[model samples]
Target: MKRLFYSSAIYTALGLLSGLFYREMSRANNFDGYSQLNVTHTHMLVLGTIMFLVFMLVEKNFSLTRHQKLFNWFFVTYHIGLLLTVAMQMTNGIMTIKGIEVSPAIAGMSGLGHIFLTVAFILFYILLNKSAFKNKK
Candidate 1:
């Protein structure tokens, strides 16, 4: 529960900062075109902060740590996925604002990050089901 709450808090900070970054960077460059950074703030808040808040609640009700391995896997994979996706977005946004040519490889990597997040999401549901079905200790 503590870990989950801390993760949510950290993500809350990251989300706010990312939004500020997007606003300031675009303004500094006088950017008017759409960029992935436009959505980075939302992605961080939803995926990072909100997801973890829900996780903490799930933990309180279902004792997610009962299945420690699955919980750990879900936690690590989720972080990797979110960070990779957001990093790519920020990189692409910066490149766009600076008039640099964006590479296809970044998109490919971002897709991979989405894959990780999908897998993590599945693992999380599985964990939830497992805990919910378990007998009280």
Candidate 2:
């Protein structure tokens, strides 16, 4: 629980910082056109902060930690994915603003990050299911 809360708080800070970065960077560059920065803000808030808050609620009711292995794996994989995704996104956004050519590998790694998040969610749902049923039977 504390872990979840801390994670959410960290993400909240990160989300706000990312938003600021996007705004300041764009303003500096006089850039108002499309860029990956646009989505970085939303992704951090929605996926990083809010998603963990939702999971915290689930943990309170479901005792997700009862499945210790799943909980640990979910925690690690979720962070790895979110960090990778956001880092690559911000990198691409910065590259765009600086008129630097973007690399294909960055996008590919971002896709892999999404895959990690997907797997983490699957583990979370499984933990939720086990916690729900373990209490029943």
Identify the candidate with maximal lDDT.
1
Clash totals, every prediction: 0, 0
Q: What is the TM-score of each candidate against the true structure?
A: 0.95, 0.96
Where does candidate 2 have its weakest 10-residue lDDT segment? 128-137
Cα TM-score of candidate 2: 0.96
Off by over 4 Å in 2: 135-137
- Local error of candidate 2 at residue 52 (angstroms): 0.9
**Residue pair clashes in candidate 1:** none
All models: lDDT?
Answer: 0.93, 0.92
Question: Per-residue lDDT for 17-72 in model 2, tens only?
Answer: 99999999999999988889989989999998999999999989889998888899
List the pairs of residues colliding in candidate 2. none
Off by over 4 Å in 1: none
